[model samples]
Target: MSVHHSVSTHHHGGSGAGWLALFLVLSLLLLGLVVAIATAIGDYAIGLDTVFLAVTNGLGLTGADISPIEQSVVWDLRLSRALVAALSGAGLAICGAILQALLRNPLAEPFVLGVSAGASTGAVCVIVLGIGGGGLSLSMGAFTGAFSAFALVAILSNGATSGPNHTILAGVAAAQLFNALTSYIVTTSGNAQQARDVMFWLLGSFGGVRWPDFHLLIIVVVLGLGVCLYMARALDAFTFGDEDAAALGVPVARIRLVLFALTAMITATIVSMVGAIGFVGLVVPHAARYVVGPMHLRLLPASAAIGAVFMVLADIASRVIVSQQTVPIGVVTALVGVPFFALILYRSRPQT
Candidate 1:
């Protein structure tokens, strides 16, 4: 009977792995399709064929007769933008999934946990206040601020012993404090032009991203994903709560610290580059979880692919939503995420 049970379990695992492989392939195809569509959109629309030709031309695969301007737009401006959007989405969604599992809170995300707010404050300090005597890059400042906020949350929550609610409340307080700091810096220190730039960045924009940004972001997201996957078993253990995980011989405290730091690093890098774009983290993980189930190994990659697709689509919507003006990417995401957020809240509410 035991041998029969073992054989059945192995067969079931194999079947599940096959399904996951199929899902991942489909997700990648969908992501590629949307990224292509994103490249083909903009102020001066290019044909999809031209988009493909431009890409191939840039790669020296086939030097088709494409206009210099069209090639530049496709290869230089829009393609990088779309790729960065995809990477940002994947990174944010991964962070969200990791956070949700670690915190065991469906709503746990960088935005909700004040990591984004902290990073924003840090970024504005470098941009407006000239912190670090102009030596500090925005990314580093944001990283410092993000880590600070995570540390503060830990202090307030008393190292996870106070439970998820207490940690959430601590996050609320951290967010308010950091947001207030950002407002004060902008209002008192920044000139009109500086204020405008800072405000626009705060709202989020993919306008400035280029190949260099993509190169950096890709590294961060890939490393972060790898690290999370390495710790997938621990994350699964975390879903059962800390005591239970510890009882299972997991070093709960150490794992929590490392994962929290990783989350801060990814959140800060993205926030510094593109500002605080919320809800990708909040919304994408739930959608991925619904399709892929709760296993971190499957869920992480699914979230990354789904998120890449979602953000590229959102970027396209941002460009075309208004006649000439591009809406902030944050606004587009909020429109979708707010409704989902409300639904989750209503469902998670205590029953009478």
Candidate 2:
């Protein structure tokens, strides 16, 4: 009996150590990727020293001397854009993951929910319609679009009566209608410059992300994740159908409202910051599920981290695609996303 007990303890100890080591390795691997991608970009590649130095220098501290131009490029330009891209991408991916589990549909995402499309419509209105320029107006417009989409979906679904799956269906209906509205605006604009400007913003770029917007994205991302963490138990309950969830003490109605609002706000923030960069939402969650399984507590953070890496790498590729001008990050994402989406559809097809 004594020998058996000792062997059992030894086996369990080894298992625990193995798991702990696995977690550490994965976390470090992801961090290393984020750092490496953050440092390496096109023609004007900065070393690890310059990346940290420029960022510190911005806060009235000195670290190293690269150049005035290089400092400006790394600190003001690249750092903010990279951070924004990472945060937005990660937040959106978490949103997507939540939605997938909530609605129990693999097809669910920002685009499918109509939040992204509605936000796109509002952004196009500002850029093409010339409401206002380059400041609060743009962010406000994008938020308006995002909220409008969520509101329309909610209202149409009769939120009091409809379930989460029902709500997703309502979103599909709303998205189709908003997409039509946006398309109409593009065709009706009739001015080449207006149309081109609208089109470009829709295609997305992190090139000129400003300090103000970057801060806002950070706040929103952090807040959204906070809400997500608090409600993770409800979300996990949501995984097992509504009836099962309710039996397990899940507040179905409240959790639905919280997640919907959180995701909409997050979607708006991302759209405002990066002009509707795609794929990160649809792909990241699926990848995270493979890594960490379906538990929201582990899944959300992992999805966010991996999603951040995904966008930064894509942004890097966008900048490197040409010698003179960088391609819009949106275009790179779309090209990649559409094919990946097709693969997903094919793989998930019912094996009838």
Candidate 3:
């Protein structure tokens, strides 16, 4: 009887693994399709066939005959933008999953640590105060500001020893401080044109991303994913709360620190490049968790894949939603996220 029970458990585990693998493969294929669609659409309106050939040609996988203009539009512009959007989405979602696990709060997200607020303040400084004196780019300034915010959070939370609540409170404080600074800089120092640019960027746009941006983002996302996957077991332990995680010999403080820094790094990179896009981190993980059943090993990858697909679709929406003008990617995400956010709140509310 015991042997039979063991066999049944093993069979169940194997079946679950197979399903997870299938989900990942399907999600990735869906992401690829969405990316192709994103590259194909826009004012120029290339077909999927052209989009494929152009991509294959750029990748040196094929020497398909394609016009230079179409090739450039597909390969040089839209493909890079779509890829960056996918990666940014993946990275943000992973960060969200990590933070939500470590902090034990379903509402927790990458930006809850104030990384986005800090990046915005940094970009504003570069844009308005001329802090870099034309040498410092907005991305660099934002990256610096983001790290600074993380550092401040670390100080306030006392390196995760103070617990998740304190860390969250610290993040809130950091966000408020940085947001106030950003507003002050924009209102007091920046010109009308500068303020307009700042506002658009703050809302998020993929229009400016190119190959270089994609290259940087891919590296960050890959590294973040690798590190997070290595610590997946630890994240799973964290879901039971910090004290329980420590009781499980999970090195609670150390894991929390590493995760906090990793999340800040990933979030800062996305925000600096893409201009503080919101809600992917907040929404994607919850959806992924619902599907994958909250095991970090499964949940993390699921979140990343879902996030990539979601962001590319959001980017497509942003382009077509307004006819001619490109809507801010952040705005598109918020429009989708707000309803989901309300749903989560409604569901998670205390029992009557």
lDDT values, one for every candidate: 0.88, 0.77, 0.90
Candidate 2 least-lDDT 10 residues: 3-12
Pairs in steric clash, model 2:
none
- Candidate 1 regions with alpha-carbon error over 4 angstroms: 1-12, 159-162, 347-352
lDDT of 3 at 11: 35
Q: Which ten-residue region of model 3 has the weakest summed lDDT?
A: 3-12
Off by over 4 Å in 2: 1-40, 59-61, 132-136, 350-352
Candidate 3 residue-pair clash tally? 0
Q: Between candidates 1 and 2, which one is better according to lDDT?
A: 1
Q: How high a TM-score does candidate 2 get? A: 0.87
Q: Across residues 1-352, which tens digit of lDDT does each residue of candidate 3 receive?
A: 4322432343336677788899999999999999999999999999999999998999999999989999999998999999999999999999999999888888889789998999999999998999979999989999999999999989988877887788899999999999999999999998999999999999999988889888888998999899999998778777767776776678988888888888888888888888989899999999997887777788899999999999999999999999989999999999999999999899888997
lDDT tens per residue, model 1, 232-252: 877887887878778767888
TM-score of each: 0.92, 0.87, 0.95
Kindly report which residue pairs in candidate 1 clash with one another. Answer: none
For model 3, state the Cα shift of residue 242 in Å: 1.6
Which regions of candidate 3 deviate over 4 angstroms? Answer: 1-12
Candidate 3, 60: how far from true, in Å? 1.4
